[model samples]
Target: MGVKNNIIAAIDIGTTKIVAIMGEIDSDGRLRIIGMEKTVSRGVKRGVIHSIEDTIGAIREVVDRLQAKSNKNISKVYVGIAGQHIRSIKNRQFKYIQNGVGEISKLDVEEILNENFRIPIEVGEQILHVIPQDFVVDKEAGIRNPVGMAGRRLDGNFNIIIGRTASARNIEKCVKEVGLEIEELVLEPLASSLAVLSEEEKEAGVVLVDIGGGTTDITVYFDGILRHTAVIPFGGDIVTRDIKEGCSVLIKQAEALKIQFGEAVADLVDEEKVVTIPSVGGWDPKEISFKTLAQIIQCRMEEIIESVKFQIELTGLHDKIGAGIVLTGGGALLRNLDVLTQRKTGIDVRIGYPDSTSKIILDEALNQPIYATGIGLILNGLNKPIENEKDLGNDKDTGSKMNLFKRFFGAMFDTED
Candidate 1:
């Protein structure tokens, strides 16, 4: 129907699956899902691309299917990125307004945020985002928006995200090889939070835990702003690996067992319940007790939960989490996972789903926790203006599209490390 360029598209390149989605913002500003497709992931591990050819093939498969289903030519898309290499740091910037007596304008705010992009970063690392946490103007503190406030001196608190240059370049290469341009590279945790967290929960303080196939992404929010973000190197795949080794089954069987019979708490499983694995390689069939399977999953899951707890402690917001923890992603589907998390962290826990946001119009089939990041990517793209094909290759620093980004969203794009 309508012009294809107006459509918002996103591709979530996860460890176990690659999801491509296209949607349109309806009259009420809700993102209505139009077409979605997923295929088995290849050449990706823990959210990082290892094999260019394989990754390209996977991207092409999903993109082609999405294009065919939607009957639209997908030229550009917003993509999500997360891996162990992703980390965030806090930095403060100060600037003297040129017109000291005038109100703080959007230009002033943009300039202060842009200054963070110039801060010294480790070699081989690039700044991905510079989000303003709060602002202080003329000795007044804790202002979220200062565009119309009058102040001579402006101070800004920022959370800056950084990632390995090679990792980012690899993602860009794969998307480009498939003839798709990345509209923006969003951090996975940030995107998932948008899909699952409500404004009140973020205002009251909450921690978002996204357990995917390869990595567990964490994001903390308080006073409706992002406080910290981190990516742990472990996720559901590790548990599957444990099952494969502990149960003496194939990887596929391990995954099936985990999805069908895995439990996060061994104590909850009945001792009499068991699953039989069909014989492989001319060997006799194997019977795995449900309790034993739960034990294996619990051991590995406990370690991951401990890691998440440790990260929360690092934020020093343990007592401030009014909404406790919200778990999302494919790994969050494990039975009794919420129970295990709440028991371990001594806080309330709930599984997060993409349907939490009224801004997303999703059917029952697309409302699962596994689609959280992919759905969130489409939501994240709504804040960004779609790119014109002619402006795709222009120098990022000098392009008109980048200027639009800076003027509208106050986002940072670093072309050089």
Candidate 2:
């Protein structure tokens, strides 16, 4: 682990659960998951924090679990933020200079980038990210890292992700109530992409589909930058419900079946295989063909992946995906999902599982593809400066992290994955 990486945490507050992950960032920048805890999330729906009290309780339990397990002092956290409120828009910001040939300074670049925060929005909206794609200096385009470059004028192209102010406030309240400060709030999808994707896949163009309980989030990258993001209302819950209705099984039983035996592609199943289902009342177990179960799952997962492809096509980057589609989240755990998605999208598909570089004991459970987002939240946290970093800041100090680009300032992930 890096000398400075004593203990860092990432909290994923999702619709179905609140997850807290503590890891040490080794000097090489790999996250070693040392402590982790997850609790059934309350006060959250559609990825938004709805009930502060319930959310606080859930957050506390998870954090407390992590603290006890790892004996790691936990305070600041890099949080994953999501929900229907999250929105992204591409915009260019311009800054004026007094002289026609004035040298562009770091302050000038900051001013131009900050202009993205000036984008108009509804009363309750706030900018979550100001991602600079490139800079145009005096009409020259495609300049990366404009700092230290001289220019008469400066402009920046950015993808600004914004979300509801009220949602953020409630999230902060819940985190603070649990005795932890929200150090940073990163978009959940962006965080996931960071942890699971590799440099080769990113530059080759790929799409990451994270299918969680309540929603299916899609993040697409081309030309080494995030090109598109979309969220589908359908997810694993949709399939579980379908099984419940189709087989007359309880929701819990349906979910159990999914975990134990579900397959996303029926063709991958043997028609002769049969699985017995529990009786609803006090009766004998019923035998059902495994083909039937696989078929049902394929129907729902196919639709979800197809919808994801539709969104990709909408962006006109469908053909550019050399890395194809990488699937993660709870839905990715379904058997044959990778095969099913590849068939549906006509592109290569692979499972997006967390890179377990940690030595913690709970790595078995958290190493699954389901925990990708939470672990990604931890990886993403590595990019942000720890608030009140022990003696890192100068005398003219404030607790805030340096900037959005601070994590990537050096030895950064050169390309998006």
TM-scores for every predicted model: 0.92, 0.88
TM-score of model 1 relative to the true fold?
0.92
- Model 2, range 281-320, lDDT digits (tens) per residue? 7867877678888988998888888899899998898889
For every model shown, the clashing-pair count is 0, 3
For residues 310-379, what per-residue lDDT tens digits would candidate 1 score against the true structure?
A: 9999989999999999999999999999999999999899999998988889889999999999999888
Global Cα lDDT for candidate 2:
0.76
> Candidate 2 regions off by >4 Å?
1-5, 27-30, 97-101, 148-150, 356-365, 386-402, 408-417
The local distance difference test score of model 1 is 0.86
Q: In candidate 1, which residue ranges exceed 4 Å CA deviation?
A: 1-4, 385-417
Worst 10 residues of 1 by lDDT: 408-417
